[model samples]
Target: MGGKQQHDIRHSDRTPAALGYSMPPEWAPHEATWLAWPHLASDWPGKLDTIRWVYTEIVRKLVPGERIHLMVRNAAEEARARQYLHRAGCPLSRVLFFHHPTNRSWTRDSGPIFVTRSQRPHPRAIVQFHFNGWAKYPNWRRDRQVPEAAARHLGMPLFEAFWNGRPFVLEGGAVDVNGSGSLLTTEECLLHPEIQVRNPGFSRRDYEAALQAHLGVRNVLWLKSGIVGDDTHGHVDDLARFVNRNTIVMVRESNPRDPNYRRLEENWELVPDLRLEDGSRPQVIALPMPAPITFDGYRLPASYANFYIGNAAVLVPTFNDPKDRLALGILGELFPDRPVVGIHAVDLVLGLGTLHCLTQQQPA
Candidate 1:
């Protein structure tokens, strides 16, 4: 299935894959992590102040490992962020601020998707996949300009993704990579026909083609769905993530009565049958789900799988639940090289996401 041609195409043959460029895994060495300052009060309701502290903690944890490229609306907002970071004892030297304005602060969905060229004088480039508020919100025009802004600021080449001559819509949270050719995604996010559909008529093959062309993905392992209360309509980040090239941590719920139990169970069952790009089965480990977090009568998408991997540490979101320790232990064992720290996210999830949802990694 294809849509009507909506834009002019140039450089159609210089796809990232054809040029030997690939999107690296999060665990790969990063030049910096990209974050947008929390400015939208409506996303966190009355919890925006708390969310700013959450951002501070995230910055504090990651700045030790790599530089933080923070985006702010203007000079005033940058000053506000500086004050917060300064109070948190974060080293301002490792934090760089950008004056790019954003409608919302979920950088993982709207920020630049960086790809690397192994055999180049120019080692890095960005693939600008059109992001339209996950196809569920209205004020995303500013967010959509993020990739171009990043490319312009870094003086790197930017490649616009297109499928059937139309701009391809993708959110970085919808897929996870292994730094190899394998990719993890869910049908519920990219292939759904009606509900928050990203591409209007794209099929599995179409997605595979688009991903290969843009991100150098060869093996597309598809999970059936994501957990309950995911407003992004089944982003892969909340259900499963690659802790290493050969291993995946898929979230599981022990309670059968929970709304997320069946959905996560289906994904766990499907993982064993999937293969990586090299035709080897991935080692699947079950990560425990946090107890359902509800605020104002709504279930929040809070899972340990939404952890962010930094160069210095793995920052996992904790919900003040007992299983928080267990989740940290499991991740700690897997990430022996660095400490696996937990960031309190009870108030942060008022915006319906946690750690991984707010940050994007830029490959070194």
Candidate 2:
């Protein structure tokens, strides 16, 4: 085993160690959220400036209690990122920049899977898996090592998984775990034979088993697909999100005429039918989709579900649509303790992702 197993967490009948790699709950704790500054000009087209401001605004909100590790290709870009963060009024102390070159800025997919285990009698923190650009984006050499490299920088054990290491594909954005043994993912992203390109002989069982072994996910609720206009090919983060163990917030499309209408409605139908590892159905909340918006002849995939839960505030991506206030109000209700601030994502969506798409939470 690439990881040393420990048995301790008594959630109900099963221990975390017995589940799989035994990563801790999402709400367990976090030192900070990790993000890689988007430098690939190809990703943002002509809107790089607008997107930088979006990220800077995001850092400003998360800097209250949680730290932010920002990755830049080199010193030149680091200075540029620093200038943007400074101009955006982000707290300098909470944001730390590293020299890691990546093909893209979606760290939530390329970055590490931070897991925690308290049963070791000592501080045990682990990061599993790496990046291969989802078998779609070519030239992922740099993105591949981010997880372990960041882990070494953080001084934690890099528990790289064995057995399942060879040809399995899973992105952090595609799977949302409540950190309580239940996981939510989209078959459109993971099960697509064209995207993940399942090994010839391996069946769905192999994929599920791999998820269980590596991510400590016991109950995987698979929704059929994801939202349209999503370039990553139907990542779950864009459709459904785990607000907590028992509560889930999903994106719903009311317009049956839209392309995403049926897919989202299908997810709505599937949500109520699933059970967690503890054998309990979750309380589901339906968040209506903001009226669809487009920019420069492109339909930017926008979702209220892409909000990032930060230490001080819940950072929401706003499309500047009329529904912005309503989305914020809803989130404010869910997270009563923290202020839900919307960062205008009209520009960020041009890059094909929002707040949570750009950051990965590093467990404390």
The Cα local distance difference test for each model comes to 0.91, 0.76
Q: List the residue pairs that clash in candidate 1.
A: none
Model 2 Cα shift for residue 94 (angstroms): 1.8
lDDT of 2 by residue, 37-65 (tens): 87877788898877888788888888886
Model 2: pairs clashing at backbone N, Cα or C within 3 Å: none
Q: Against the true structure, what is every candidate's RMSD? A: 4.1, 4.5
Could you say which candidate leads in lDDT? 1
lDDT for model 1, on a 0 to 1 scale?
0.91
Residues 120-153, candidate 1, lDDT per residue (tens digit)?
5558888888899989899999999999888878
Among all windows of 10 consecutive residues in model 1, the one with the lowest summed lDDT is 1-10
> In candidate 2, residue 132 scores what lDDT?
67
Taking all chains together, the TM-score of candidate 1 against the true structure is 0.96
Which stretches of candidate 2 lie above 4 Å from their native place? 1-21, 121-124, 164-167, 196-201
